[model samples]
Target: MIDVRDLTKVFATPHGDWLKAVDRVSFTVAPGEVFGLLGPNGAGKTTTLRMLLGLIRPTSGSATVAGFAAERDPAEVKRRVGLVSANTGVYPWLTARETLAYFADLYAVPPALARQRIAEFADAFGLGDFLDRRCGVLSTGQKQRLNLARALIHAPTALLLDEPTLGLDILGRRIVEEFLELVQARQLAVVLCTHHLEEAERLCHRFGLLNRGRIVRQGALEQLRAETGLHSLHAMFLDLVGARRQLPVTSLKSAAPPAPLT
Candidate 1:
């Protein structure tokens, strides 16, 4: 359902420097499969996703989603894909039902079908009781549920999720996981970008470890585990990219103390 080949994106910095956020990355996500883009911050996952969604242009390479070229036929690509993110762009003033209806209109879903889908998703995601409540009044978990509902209102063929469970509690995360399982059961193609290895292991059939603007490893979960001789996804991730840690850089001036005390 999705094919990407040597995709790269470079941003020109104000300092006359070029920052390559994504470099020579390539992978394919088949129908009925959940593909995970696993990486740490600044690892190029978001840049690659934006390129695939046609939200940003790539410096080089190409990608196709649902048979439409991502760069050249973005409209066609958008029509076939649904997207949900941690910072889902939802209007705080709109009620949950209104939110779904609004997206339905954007997708040009038929009235009757839209109503039916709204009802189904609201109930499935436990948004029925709060359907009339304004989104701003909802909790973090409720808002996340509403985000997923909005994304599915049109029943797009593919899904792109960026940190869908990023700020949620345990219960909220489970709800997202369950919804994703349903998507998989329906043979929908899904590309998930996340830092949560456990979530990826639970939902994804295949995995790609992206590091330093490139895909360092790609394979099925079992294959990656076997090839890397790792017992768990976390172990495999650390083995492939090592652990991510912050380094504090202290200035020499700061280190030189009490110079005037004499």
Candidate 2:
């Protein structure tokens, strides 16, 4: 349901040279599958997502969400995708129920069905007790859960989650995991951008390891292990960085990104 090919984004640096935020990145997420876009800070994962969502235009290449080209059919693509980021938030003064309702309306969902989805999400996210409470009064976890529900208020075919489980307690993380499972059960494609490698291993069916704006390695976890002889995503991730970390600064800056997995 989500496809990106040669998706590149370049920005002008302060010194007037170009910086490639994302470089020829490519991936696909099928229905009922989660594809982890794993990387560290400044790795361009979020830039890739922003390009996919058409929030920012890419320098080149294509992104198609639910078969609609993001550059050409942005509105349709947006309608078919749900986005949840750590920064996603609800209106402080709006009641929890009101916030969901507002989002549903923005998607043009019918009133009756919107009410049904609101109820289902409230139950799924454990918002039952505070469904009528003002969002500003809700706890951190509560707000995060509400943000998750709000992203899916229209029941999009794909979900793009960037750091959805960041800064939360164990319970909050568990709830987010359960919610991802629930969405997968409904056959939604998911693109998860996160630094939480252990969580990614547990939740993602496949992963693309991005570094310095390029895909350094990508495949199913087992495939990655077979190629690298690394037992865990965390280990493989460290291996990739370790391989480059020892290089002198000049070589590191001039070095090309690792080749894609065959």
Candidate 3:
């Protein structure tokens, strides 16, 4: 499970001004559920994920994965979660089978168990044909399949995906779409950060729509549609962000950050 409460990040500009990258963000993802964090560029999606990984300090608020506070226990939170991004690159010299084994080793998975998982993901992700081939020789779809499998070799409880389908052809995107179902079947809590609203609507169980450092609105696809009187996330998003004109962005100084889930 993943829990975030009142997460915020502020950066100091060269001119001695503070820029708020994320503002009082809070949400949760139950095991086996997928939550889409949809936003335009600079909506604080990456900032939020970085804080959850404890790569940077949050100006305020907290994030926890599997009961480990990300700020206080970075290593433990990392162990329970895996990250896959569009920029994920496989080692060109490593064979597909070797790639999976290498990551399993990094996580200290038993050699015997690592082999078992390699074989299982090979079958599940249809990597059996190219399992022995070097990553450099693999097609984009095949390489991505291996990348997805590699991230899960240690059996993480939660996964963070950033534009997993970006720069992919139709076939490569299809491969990722199929892989998402398998991820869900394993009961991993998933946070999908993407600009692909259509894809999110099809894959995510719920969503947190963010704009200009704030979560302008959040809920399931149907709920968001009903709330905005729009059919598509693309449409709903535009409608909500436009509403921001009247909403007025303000400092959260007096606002209490969301409480961690009990």
Candidate 4:
């Protein structure tokens, strides 16, 4: 499970001004559920994910993963979560199998259990044929499979995916979608940040629509449609962002931020 309450982050810019990357964001993800954080570029999606993973500290508010506070117990929080990003790296010299084993070691999984998981993931992700191939020589799709496999070796109870299908072909995207279904079946909580409205509409149980670092609207697709009186996610998003008015650019302010949504 993931719980965030009034989570906010402000950064000091080079020009001696403050920028609110994430502003009073609050949401929850229950086990067996996928929560979509949908937004455009510079909408604070990445900053919020970083705060949840404990990669950076929040300026205010709180976040907890599986009952462990991300700021107070970062290690425990990380133990319960797996993260996947488009920029995830694979050690060039290591084989796909070796990469999984290495992360298993980092997570301190028992040697016997690590082997069991490696074998399981290899089959589940269809990595058997090239499981021994050097990562540097594998195709893009192959490397991404390895990336997902490596993240799950420890059997994290929650997953965070940021643009997991950014540059994939149809087949590559299908693999990721299948993997997400597997996570759902296993009853793990997942938070997916993506720009693909169609993918989110298909997979997420609910969504939080972010604009200019604030959650302007959030709910299931039907709920959002009713609230905005807009039939499609694309149309609702455009209205919320004022994109039809030449996409109004919101200026950053360091004053008291808006109250978070319930």
Q: Which candidate comes out best when scored by lDDT?
A: 2
**TM per candidate:** 0.91, 0.91, 0.89, 0.92
For residue 109, model 4's alpha carbon misses the true position, in angstroms, by: 0.8
lDDT per residue for candidate 4 within 153-240, as digits (tens), equals 8999999999998888889988999999999999999999987888888999999999888898988889998898888888877787
> lDDT tens digits, residues 1-262, model 1?
9999999999999999999899999999888899999987899988998899898989999988988998999998888899999988678899999989999999999989999999899778999889999988999999999998888888888899999998899999999998998888877899999888888888898999888899988999889877888767888777667653556899988786766755
Ranking by TM-score: 4, 2, 1, 3
What pairs collide in candidate 4? none
When summed lDDT is taken over every stretch of 10 residues in candidate 3, the lowest stretch is: 240-249
TM-score preference between candidates 1 and 3, better one? 1
Candidate 2 segments exceeding 4 Å error: 243-262
lDDT of 2 by residue, 1-262 (tens): 8889999999999998999999999999999999999987888999999889888898999999888999898899999999989888779999999999998999999999999999999888899999999998998899999988988899899999999988999999999999998999999999998888999999999999999999989999999999889899888888766753565556676889899999
Query: Lowest summed lDDT over 10 consecutive residues: which window, candidate 2?
Result: 241-250
Error of 2 at 18 (Å): 0.4
**Whole-model lDDT, candidate 4?**
0.91
Off by over 4 Å in 3: 240-262
Residue-level lDDT of model 3, residues 1-262, one tens digit each, is 8999999999999999999999999999998899999998889999999999988889999999999999999999888888988888989998999888888988999999999999898888899999999999988778878888887998999999999888778877887787788888889999999888889999999999998889988898889878878889888777756743455667798778999999
52, model 2: CA deviation in Å? 0.3
- As for TM-score, the candidate ahead, 2 or 4, is 4
